[model samples]
Target: MGRKKVLAVIHTVAYGKRLLEVLSLLEADFRLQVVFTAPPHAFGDDVPAFLARLGSVVLPWAQATRMTFDLALAAGPRGVQYIDAPLITLPHGANYLKRVTEGPNAGVAGLRRQDLLPGGRLPAAVVVPHHAELRELARDCPEALPLAHVTGDPVHDRITASLPLRAAYRRALGLDEGQKLVVAVSTWGADSSFGRFDALLPRLIGELPAPRYRTALLVHPNVWAGHGAYQVRSWLARCGQLGIGIMPPEADWRSVLIAADWIIGDHGSVSLYGTLTGAPMLLATSSEREINPSSPAAALAAHAPTLSPTHPLVDQLDYAAQEYRPEEYAAIGSRITSEPGRFNRNMRKLMYGLLGMGQPAHEPVTVPLPEPLPLNAWAPGHGEVSA
Candidate 1:
């Protein structure tokens, strides 16, 4: 038989980057194609580009509508499988029904309840990173099967590899040799809940004693694009006015992670990477409960200090993240760093399994898989599976 072809549909650069890393390890076993919803326009576009250059076909998101299920069905007959990486459901909340019914690309677009049906015709498998997400998907689309919960995030792996030389990294970034570095990776949200650094900026600046520690803020591309360069410039100006040495967002954040003495940010996989790198980290929670932490994110928070409005340090700095007791953080952190190869190995297993190559023999790590919830429990209207 010929090599099995696999197409990975990813919604963002981060997920695409992880897909690429997994594909890179399995290039010898299968033919791979990577489809992205947009170009790599984020802080970590390098990984995505590298993967595309390494023989993964890039399909424009706009052009995807023309192909439809017909294309996937044709490919399936030839031993090709379509895999949708973790995708956020569109039209979130009350607007969901109205938006799906009225959108230009409405009526059974992308991966939906109908696609997972026995003869409805979709890919052989769909890969979701977190069990909570998988449970939600299963509840909404019962026909879909639960694949392995492969926890390996390429971004986390990249960040982990850079932690050892953090001191040298600090010196290279021109921060004072003795001063500790605190890095904050901001996120973009519809409400000001996650991205509002305006209140926290001045307070964090005041908390750090000049020449004792310096803070570097790495804003997500979505936030920077939405707020513009002027917002960042203004923040930098304020830091300068307060005698704080602000490091401009010029370097790739993975390298910046290498230089960081401590990290603080809203819930995201980046924080998980920080934990894997063994960086002293903190999480800023969302007031609106918009940002939900993944398993790894929760695992990392279990090890690190979580800053919240109630903490004593909350008054010292105007940021928000639930504090993780010292013992919890240490326990979780130790487990993550103990087996560096667990993530890579498991990811390889999932990729190979999707291609029907059977599972490879590998030592298993004690990563717990959360219980899968029934589909009917979440969305009652989705019971009629697509035929």
Candidate 2:
């Protein structure tokens, strides 16, 4: 049989990152040729550079949709229905948490009824992380429910799989014995942690002594791509000077999450997914208007302690841990994904089935999360690595 071609529709840097995780299953198989494209998106800034860094050949959005392919995969919904191939669409974030602010799909997240059925068409499959999302799809886009599949979350599997290496991860991040790593994460937009608490990183740096607490800032890739890298760096210059390590947009954030002793974050996937790392979590921000009330992200906001920017940062951190309940957080983790450690296996089977080909003759591997990026090095010294 001829080698199959796959088109990966990367709508943004964030989606590209998630798509890369799913694509890892395809790496060992030499029978497929995969190309990429960055459809027009507000956060499509760093996509070409990101793909170029990987030495990936990309076809322009217009040109790519015109041609036929064996399969097409996308993490976000942006001009995907036009692609001429059997398409599989996955959520960029682990849960369909965010409530859409505008457009025809407003009030709901990006998964629009029209997106699921653009002019009486449906994607070959819609992969959701949890079965609960199937209900959401049924209510929002019932016609697309039959096409929905629950393959589980790659990020959920990776974070949970790396828990045993937590100590090693801490060491790689330069966290000495007795030092706690406080990772402050934020999703993009005005409702994110950074938006609600602008001084969160600096507060963590200033209030908590460097010897006892090491601080790191992990923002969504869309934040970096939305405002040019220069602007985002400029905004965080003071925090950087104070030694708050800003994680690179493309870095493996799972490493940071794994090593983290305390995660103070907003209503983002990384924050909610941080529960699996065995680290007690505290909410740095929340947006009732933005987060779906029934979604898992919202469920976390309901359970975890909310960090007060004005209050003593260390005291709140102490309180959160002291009041932590593993059972509650574990339940939240359960909601993130149904199939534990099976993302690679299930995705590979689905892809190969679409290709009408036999299996690779070996067990599909769930690749381990790598060490934290040197660019996001967290230590006592005051240094910065801006993306």
Candidate 3:
């Protein structure tokens, strides 16, 4: 019998990297074709090359209208099953295309209600990142079937797998021994009207007592595009004048994060990455109105030292970090890390079922949470690690 074909549609490089990683792991079970919205550039350039290296056929769809419908039509006649990962929503131009061109057996992975119709029927199965994301999806869209919550994000799994090269990474970044590194990551929409980073950045940078650690300010591409690189460079110049060694915003942020002793940022997926690296995360938000607390990013901050510029929750931050042990971190990590394999297996089974083939003999993998780690040891000097 011929191998079943699957079309994995990834909207961005981050999500593309993730889907590609899982596809690589499941390569033997099915024929995979990757359709991306655009070819990666600048910081995201590594993703497509990485996917190509994994031996998948990569197709770039550039025009929004043609990209959505044409790609689906091209894949459909070839008997390819469709899967949407993370942020590939049904709204925008894709919605009409999805309805017109999608094969009968199309599915959505990591789907949430906000990404679909208000009363829409759930797809074949929903892929989630963790229990937290699953809970949020359930609360928001109860109709969706919980096909699986893969413990690990493919991107994170790739990141964690590279941990052994830390020393070499540190050397490449030009870091000296014993000089502590702190990474401050900027998020998209961080400069919106509700965001007070103009005031917050200066205060945060001023508060950092230097010579103890070197700070790297990693600006988001969106922010750079909005304000321009020259503006970011000028701001970093001001930060440097204040004694903070601002790492160029153009550097590969994942590598920078890997080399950091700590991370400070607004709530984002990067915090989850920080958790995997065993780095202390200091979350800096502008105000409660600026972010949704129920968000996956916020949920991550709830379990860590999240600080808001306008509303200081210092005492709560201190207590949470001190109280939660390292074993707890390990437990959380394990819970989130175990999901990828199960997701891959289920995806394979779903494709087979859609193809009218007998269900694959794939079993879902369950990963037990690890014991909490000692929080006190990593907590005390944590304040000095953030901007």
Number of the top-ranking candidate, with TM-score as the measure: 2
TM-score of every candidate relative to the true structure: 0.56, 0.94, 0.57
Residue-level lDDT of model 1, residues 1-387, one tens digit each, is 433434444433333433444444544433443343333234333334334444446566445433432112110111122223222111111001111234443332222454334244444445443334454455556666453253434444445555555565555656665766677766556433235566567557766666776666655444544455466557567665654433322224566665666677655534545554445566665322332233334445444445665455433232322342445554544433333445566555655554546654444332321221121121112111100
**lDDT comparison, 1 vs 2, better candidate:** 2
Top-lDDT structure, candidate number: 2
Model 2 Cα lDDT, one tens digit per residue, 289-350: 89988788888989999987578988998899999898888898888888888888888889
C-alpha RMSD for every candidate: 12.4, 3.1, 10.6
Pairs with steric clashes in candidate 2: none
Give the clash count for each candidate: 6, 0, 16
lDDT of 3: 0.44
Q: Rank the candidates by TM-score, best first.
A: 2, 3, 1
Error of 1 at 106 (Å): 19
Regions of candidate 3 where Cα sits further than 4 Å from its true position: 1-33, 38-114, 117-124, 131-139, 146-151, 190-197, 200-212, 225-252, 286-303, 306-325, 328-387
Query: What digit string (tens of lDDT, one per residue) describes model 3 on residues 1-387?
Result: 544444454433334434434444344444434444333233343344434534556555333323322112111111112323222121111001111114542322223442433234234444445555555555556665344333334444445656666666666555677766666765556433115457656654655555555666665544554565467667556665665544432223455667777767664445545666666666665234433444434345456665555554334334445665666555545544445335445444544444455643555332221211111111111211110
Error of 1 at 276 (Å): 3.3
